[model samples]
Target: WAIGLLEVAFSRYCPITFGIRTMGLMGLAYAHYSFWPIWSIPIMVYAFLPQLALASGISIFPKISEPGFLLYLFLFLGAYGQDCLDFLLEGGTFRKWWNDQRIWLIRGLSCHLFGTLEYLLKSLGISAFGFNVTSKVVDDEQSKIYSQEMLDFGVPSPMFVTLAVAAIVNFFSFSFGFLQMICGSDDNEGLPLQMLLAGFIMLNCWPVYEAMVLRTDKGKMPTKVTIIAAFLAWTLYAAAFHISFSK
Candidate 1:
């Protein structure tokens, strides 16, 4: 997120500092914006916002009958289809393409979220940030242990927890929207796209679900992480509900 912001910022401020330059430099600045920060930050922040609003009886997302909703859906499908086509054109297998998609979701929920938060907190002078150098060398004993264990323990706990909570929240949101549609609610019309979005997130979260519920390997999500994620998701829903009623 910072990289993207910095690119645009430089584009704007560099001209004022060093007089006007070619339009090519301006284009270069904007074109250099990192895809991860440009898209993933917004995805991380807004993934559940509209659903939370709807849970609170607030209509923020577009209804299925609305042109905006169709546009949004088409935009998603078009980008996704294009990506798939690119992968196939490059001779990637279906399974590899699917794994790449899931990895994108995982990185968005975990690394992108952390990166954005770190950037903001540092900018606000609330936190200190610096790069730390680590050894690249690996010993045979340690390498063997890591290979044998296949543990996800190397990842920071917060990242795992964030990923788990995102999966759980999306799962619950999709289920809630599904149930509402099945019950024939008047408000179901506005929920289709939201539900579809949630369901898409949930589908990409299959690995997390497997780790949380099915896997017995060392790579599985810990019991504490599952408990924490479930609690956080419930708390978010409860808070949204309370706010809606209070309003």
Candidate 2:
């Protein structure tokens, strides 16, 4: 995640630095937190191959959503015509049709409630009028099922997890803080480039822990304990960063 932020800061000079690339890195971190072998295996693979493999599997599910919705939606939205003739019908007014569309999309997605829930949970005040399915009969008894994620990403690497906590805190701190600096001119200081630089650097720079420590620290520390340590890292990192860089 840190690497991504740095890349963005270096290349994609947005008003808020490291916006897009940090997204990739954050996904990597989340995988490290929520899925142990998932992220680790990819890293191991990348370590070995170092050529073709990218440790981006953690980002697969995440990047394939609403924002990424644009990519495939063009292909599917075209099918909306078929959706109208074959899928959507009478709701009442155009607004009614739109609301109906939402309900139908939700219900048709019953087969994959988990994926559907992914969209629903993130969307707030999102109720709308579109395609609504009045009566739908579909048997879920024979639905094909795959495995579920083991658990939260933290279960595996639970030891001395100051780094993980620091990552999360740094993510929100820099991400939101940058947003604030951009959106609200209350105290805007031209992007705080130095603070952003610190955040990106601190994200990747950490003490070298022996392999034994990393392997042994399986859910050893409490979540709360690590959370505190994480924020401290960010605070110290950002403060030291701006202090050194300030003119």
Candidate 3:
């Protein structure tokens, strides 16, 4: 039903049709059908690179979202909030002293310093750096970054430089991922890129792995025919990409 609804909603605005049309400007999407497996070979190769990041202390384990955990975060926050209320609205002298002591800590995390910084960074599309400097937008009246007047879509128009910068950032991102896939596993290994490829291969399997490992106890791999079909399809897609840009 969701797929039916999506088809109804986007039938006229078909993205794949549009995407293929865009690709036609350079070359047909299916121009190179054979080279995909070669490109995807590295996907498996780089799959282990993230392990290097973890061993080197630069990354952390993935946090798969679990149901009901958000309720826990909210409850924990509410309990803390209630404690704050008891220290504030409750009239005992000791309570008042305690509230004064904790006020700075609360103030620091509230819509104040660090929270504002976290919001700012997310807005800039700089999240790849792994820093949360700011969160939601501050009201114009309260924000000094923009004037009190002009506003559209709750965001400013995209700047040319912003697009260029995003492209550049994405280029480095692909380079880093590719580098990990091609590079050293050890002293005898050539480059570190294989690590990234291993990570990619794991990511490719992640949806099912996560489902069976965490979300469900049942474990099963699809039929061998299906697996081969998936690989061939993925490889063909990769081949197209590689062929289009191999020059």
Candidate 4:
């Protein structure tokens, strides 16, 4: 019961990030099952194996040989490998698709990371908000206009503000952690992995950073949202400092 409650709380906090990905993956699976049943087996295996490995920390196949692990890794790559192949078959150049992937990765990671911070704040009772609509339709003319005006990219929401704060915080956190490790600090035991993950998260959050500070797009962070997010960010930072140092 307690676990279920925790799950509900988590879901509420980062509502759409993983949900959107899961839905996309599910739709892909459904398409494969409907039109190309034979490929479904490999697709399912590729999708599930990495998750199993993560959940069990590879303990489920503890004695697996290196070759077995490599095979699993290849299968994991197959998920995206299939997409690349599809793009090629559809007359898309590899270079173009590869370039496009960078944009997609930025958008995806930014959304997920920002949503995560929003969720954390919500769980701590520091932030609260209602539903925000995500539109499916794109208006080419409006996009052109916004692009011409150098306006922000999407809706002006607290999410972007949170993302901006997170990007800055993670950037500094990673830098300090990396410096500590390089200087061979005594307390740098788990800092490497933490710093690496933080760096990766920030790398994928370039879009947010650009939207918030670099670009004048229609999707840029609004002043009011920025102020609110800055306050929340400071609150979180203080709480983390207290928790880490008080111990």
TM-score per candidate: 0.76, 0.23, 0.20, 0.47
lDDT (Cα, tens digit) per residue for candidate 1, span 99-202: 78877777777766666666666657786455444455666754764676332533337678878878888887777777887889888778877777778888
Candidate 3 per-residue lDDT over residues 14-61, each given as its tens digit = 434543566653332332221222222232222223333322323332
lDDT of 2 at 216: 31
The 10-residue segment of model 4 with minimum total lDDT is 50-59
Q: Where does candidate 1 stray beyond 4 Å? A: 1-35, 129-156
Off by over 4 Å in 4: 1-142, 145-154
Model 2: per-residue lDDT, tens digit, 1-247?
2223233333544324343356655645543423221233332222122111111101121122345435444544565455665434543454445445533332222222222333343344465333333333323421211122111222333223433433444444455555655678453342343234325323332221221124233313344645655666566556545644573
Worst 10 residues of 3 by lDDT: 151-160
Which candidate ranks first by lDDT, i.e. highest? 1
After best superposition, candidate 1 residue 222: deviation in angstroms? 1.6
Task: Kindly list the per-residue Cα lDDT of model 4 for residues 141-213, writing each as its tens digit.
Answer: 5577456643354576543554566566666666666666678866554343345445655765666566666
Name the lDDT of candidate 3.
0.35
> Residue 58's C-alpha lDDT in candidate 2?
13
Candidate numbers, best lDDT first, in rank order? 1, 4, 2, 3
Question: What RMSD, rounded to one decimal, does every model reach?
Answer: 4.5, 22.0, 24.6, 11.7
Q: Which stretches of candidate 2 lie over 4 Å from their true place?
A: 1-147, 151-163, 181-221, 241-246
Off by over 4 Å in 3: 3-207, 210-218, 241-246
**Winner of 1 and 4 under TM-score:** 1
Query: Where does the lowest 10-residue lDDT sum fall in candidate 2?
Result: 50-59
**TM-score of model 3 relative to the true fold?**
0.20
